[model samples]
Target: MSRTTFTLDDLKRILLEGSGVPEGADLRADILDTDFTDIGYDSLALLETASRVEREYGIELDETVLGDATTPRAFVDAVGAHLSAQPV
Candidate 1:
């Protein structure tokens, strides 16, 4: 039950690399703790990000958890939890 540790930078990268985020919208470090809506992410973008995470980590994340994630840390935590629960 080892969870793959993902950094904030990794989350940012996923957001940037994945589609739906406003083009050229800078995801500054200061905004990691900010709400996704405040940071300019729409629901579709979040869903896309979740899809990418699931595909990248090969884990099925809870949609409810992902939908409720307002900050990058929350998303990271949810993903980490899912990863940790995975069979080794």
Candidate 2:
């Protein structure tokens, strides 16, 4: 089933599975506002994560929007917005 909202937990799981967590990066910590770059997630990693999220959720996420989402919170919010716009 498709999801209606994207949460931080989802991001963490996807990040781990899609790109593998970087060394010394603590995903379990409070990283909502932490910049993706700070945690070793670069544009390529974020793109991969976005691709995985799109495939899993059956929603298309704009690359530009994803690029704008520098933090996990913003990424989740961007995915949530796309999910909400999808047909029920």
Candidate 3:
């Protein structure tokens, strides 16, 4: 099997797809200053999103790290880092 270079947009697309969110919805718009609560992204929603992201990105997100990402930017940064560190 081959691996793909995951990009920020790719991550966003995957999240949207997995979560059944609408197209064009900004995934990184309120990052850094807002929490998932602000965007209606609850724990269940997050779980679904994370599971989807895990499958799409082929990575296992660290719960400890996910806790630190309370905003969109953090999520993006975390996902980027995870993607880089993922085994090829």
Candidate 4:
């Protein structure tokens, strides 16, 4: 088995694409530091993005983390941590 690695930027892209952010929407770098609420993502949006992450990475994310992560950076960190712990 081999481990897969992804960066915060990768996760950011995934979130932008999976969270139903509309076309022509301006996604600024502040997304990395801003709350998802500020970025117009709600619980449903996060859930959808989390599902995408799980499917893409073939890993299970803890529901608590999925639900509680407030910012894109936090989500990226949580997923990265979980992915690092998965068996390779």
Best by TM-score: 2
What TM-score, to 2 decimals, does candidate 2 have?
0.93
* Sequence-dependent TM-score of model 3: 0.66
Per-residue accuracy of model 2 over 1-88 as CA lDDT, tens digit each? 5778889999999999988989889998999999999998998898889889989899988868776899999999999989989888
Off by over 4 Å in 2: none
Candidate 1 per-residue lDDT, tens place, 1-88, comes to: 2237666777888888886356556676577678887777878888988888888888887768766788887888888888888877
Stretch of 10 with least lDDT, candidate 2: 59-68
- Between candidates 2 and 3, the one scoring higher on TM-score is 2
Error at 49, model 1, angstroms: 0.4
- Model 4 misplacement above 4 A: 1-3, 22-25
- Cα lDDT, model 2, residue 32: 95
Best by lDDT: 2
**Model 4 quality (TM-score):** 0.80
Q: TM-scores across all candidates?
A: 0.83, 0.93, 0.66, 0.80
After best superposition, candidate 4 residue 63: deviation in angstroms?
Answer: 0.6
Ranking by lDDT: 2, 1, 4, 3
lDDT of each: 0.77, 0.89, 0.65, 0.75
Q: Which order, best to worst by TM-score?
A: 2, 1, 4, 3
lDDT value, candidate 2, whole model: 0.89
Per residue, candidate 4 scores C-alpha lDDT tens digits across 29-72 of 55677777777777887888888888888888898986668977
Find the number of clashing residue pairs for candidate 1. 0
